[model samples]
Target: MKKLISLIFTLTILVFQMNLYSQKIFPFEIKEHKLSNGLKVIVVPYNSPGIVAYYTVVRTGSRNEVEPGKTGFAHFFEHMMFRGTEKYSDVEYNRILKLLGADSNAWTSNDQTVYHIVASADALETIVDIESDRFKNLKYNKEQFQTEAGAILGEYNKSALNPFQILNEEMQKLAFTTHTYRHTTIGFLEDIKDMPNQYDYSLQFFDRYYRPEYCTIIVVGDVSFNKVIYLIEKYYGDWKRGSFEPNIPAEPEQKEERSKEVKYPNKTLPYLYIGYKVPAFDSKSKDVAALNVISELLFSETSELYQKLVLDEKLVDFISGEMPMDRDPSLFRIYTRVKDEKNVERVKQEIYNAIEKLKLEQVSPKKLADVLSNMKYSFLHSLDNADAIASTLAYYVSVTGNPYSLDEFYQTL
Candidate 1:
């Protein structure tokens, strides 16, 4: 009996020490530099032997499309950027990528567009040269611009086939009244239809947002910080900065609860989404931490609600909740797919009941500690490779413009 007590006490001490160590969650030294031209660069010296992940985060998304008729230009640029610059034609760019055996792609979201490449470390110089050239000297004629626009229209049509996509579009339109978040990242269908005729406007959009001040370069892997900076200076130093500042409109407060129902053209299991207006992502906010905790406590697979709704009653095949990190105020959304259409209301009410229980009752300290520890360790386990580390930091850098915010956020949790 005495030995058992002693072992338990030692384990407790070890856990306490581990929790203290985890306060500084980011294991690598983050080196940052700013250029005279207003470009920012972040370097992480990861242990990968011969590979690196390069990411360029453009802080413009559909949220920056505030003009009357230009809603899809940001995503359009995601496609157009690959059309290649004057120095590097699309064919030549593809050839070079194939030579280096590189994987490269770009994606646009509500708040930012990110371009990423995973390649050998030896190819870093060529990567910098081509990327800098494209950002600084990209040129496309009217025909090329219109071709990409039409392609985007086709892409939009394809995405519209998904019922969840339709529901998300309606939700955004219903959620915000004045903010550009009223539109999805793909923008509206009408704007995409009009995109082919807006070749001149496309030039202006690129000129406005593709500037040094609105971008950040992140390099993670077996790389030296000083070497990365020197290469950046050699290639991107002469690139001039632009003086465009977007007037992004702020969303106003919701005075009352709002709901909308979206109908699907094809038969499918009924999906239910409930979103509550929540505070924006803040690294130091206790409210944000609490929301994160609540998401797990009330909706995780082990939660009473999930056990009842999914395991016991077998009403829902899937149910989950998330507080997505966004630069501006976003949703704390609970989502579920009901097996039967008639049970949608019951599932929703059950979720409400679970939320009310969370508000009325306090979780035991042991459970809270367990959840926090799991969340922290799960994140730590994901940083196993260069690409994973860069990808994780890219999202935080997009939202907060500081990779260190990950440490601050986890500390709060």
Candidate 2:
């Protein structure tokens, strides 16, 4: 008994040390500067020679669309942002990017919209000038706005063809009653169809959300913090802050479980998604940490449930679960696609059984330690390049408006 106890104690110390060492994996110093206009600049001096990943994170998304008919405007702006400013037309912007051999794109999510560019370090000044100009002086007529809105409607119709998309739409709608999360980032089909008529409203959406107060500029690569800050100030300093605050309605606590079935017009394998209401992400919360651990323990590929349903019985094609960090309370979801419709119930029961086992039995300390170690190392391994580091930080920045939250969240894990 004494020998077993000593061994466990030693193992615990080693795991603690490993986690501490892993915390240092984010090797570069993160320098942050806030402009007087409320724009934040985060610079990470990575060792990648002559390459830079520049990201502009706007802290607004479909979640800000609180009014009834404005659901898809946030996403619509993702497309419209490229329409260019008075200084640089869409054609001119493309020509300049091609000249610099840069790759640029933008994406919108439930909580934020991000625009990213990967270019040479020397082109940073031009990058800042163009990006800042677009944000501050974007110019588009009703014709251009309507054209993009129509394109978004077409994109929505194309996405509806995917069964999983339909399932996700149904799941979100069934999960919440009041929160804007009830809608997908692309928003409702009806709202998307009405988008063309909402061109004037689109301008208002931009005016409300596209401001220095709601923006962060992240520059990662072989860059100097002083130089980055200087360029940002020179270009983005005069941008005015807007006073609009979204009056997002709080979601009432769910008292009962909800379920919905989405019928796909096209033939496809049966899909199952089960979600439980989880709290807003807090890096210091033990409850949130436990949810992350439980997701891996019950559903990851190494879990007993996965071995039984996927490898042994061959019932499910894939099984996974995630409780992604969000600005507001969100769902911890388990998803699977069964090979046959008849086995869907069986797979669901097997997942439930796994959850019950976790509740009834304590996981061995050694096993728990191993899971934590793997999770830490997996994340550390992904920070291999400048773009990867910036992209990773962008998500944390969008959620909490702080890049260091990544460290806090990892430490909590």
Candidate 3:
């Protein structure tokens, strides 16, 4: 009777997942259009009555910083973009944003830079005009550029003070040989210092990347798709496409495990990160899904490893794992903060043991089903607001150049 019950439960999960996969998970209808110059625009009309989220997803980041001595421009633009255009000075831009009651910010990652604005729905057209003008007409004199460069150096020095930052910087430097991922998004310390002197190179960098061909606009709110498209075309239509394409170097496979040690002067608990080279993210691949499940199974609080190392053995204060979604092959990393220096080796060995066990056995069907269900529920729950919806779609759009990729990704699970 117990066996029959288990079989019935397995069948039920299988049926539910099958039905879910056959349709889209995004509740709203996503409307899309591409300008003649290659700027992709996406709109999601939600029930929210008075607010909107605008995102300009630039499909360029430190990953495209492949040329020697040219790293960090992608991240630099995150600051430079706010310097404003000739038509709208920095002060005017700030004042306008304040008038509209908008919250705006931008961030650069390994594979993309995203600028977002959340404001009253009535201000959508003005927001569109300001964003379009800047992307096309961004201007900064050498003195202004140099001032920002100095600020970046100051920011970098401050970040260097953090042990966690130092560890992460060292880990990436050790992990990759030829890929741009070897450096942090902030680029090399030397390049950032030299940035002010490279005024000509700066213009070229913007010319190459700040083009319509490399950008996408996403708006989600209580809005109309037609009006959004019209406003986007009116403001951004004339932006020209550039012919430059960056040749990012492919990362070579690791033949042996790599290790690095950092001894910070500041006294703190020793932390360890063990990363295994993994394939690039593919939402349709079973291997990626299986790997994601394995990450949660081995390191989540519910895992036996966590119970042994933290709850009973008391070797670690915190332990977690991540398999980040990326456009290129990346790492599946396990991180731990150890309570005692002496227990570091023991904790590392236990992590290795967990990996070995996973290789030798399959996760039970019941457990796998539970994790997948929880993941789906969490994803659905995250889409509870306009900003959440736009941010979610922006991520998928950056990865696959299609917002519907989110639907396919969830269905794959």
Best by lDDT: 2
Residue pairs in candidate 3 whose N, alpha carbon or C atoms collide under 3 angstroms? none
Clashing pairs in 1: none
Give model 1's TM-score versus the native structure.
Answer: 0.94
lDDT per residue as tens, model 2, 1-413: 00112322343344444455445446679999999989999999999999999999999988999999779887888888999877999999999999999999999998999999999999999999999999999999999988998898889889988888999999888988899999999999889888888877888899999999999999999999999999999999999999999999999977766777788988999999998777788875656766787777778889898899889989989999997788998888889999999888888888877776666566777888888877878887998999899999999999999888888777756
Candidate 1: tens digits of C-alpha lDDT, residues 252-286: 87877788888898888999988878778998665
Candidate 3 per-residue lDDT over residues 215-329, each given as its tens digit: 9999999899999999999999999999999988998877777888899988889999887777787877655665666677788888889999999989999899887788898
Give the poorly placed runs of model 3, Cα more than 4 Å off.
1-22
Consecutive 10-residue window with the lowest summed lDDT within model 2: 1-10
Give the runs in model 2 whose Cα sits over 4 Å from its true position.
1-25
Which prediction has more favorable TM-score, 2 or 3? 2
TM-score of model 2 vs. true structure: 0.94
RMSD of each candidate relative to the true structure: 6.8, 5.2, 5.2
TM-score of each: 0.94, 0.94, 0.93
Query: Each candidate: what lDDT?
Result: 0.85, 0.86, 0.85
Q: Residue 379 deviation, candidate 1, in Å?
A: 0.6
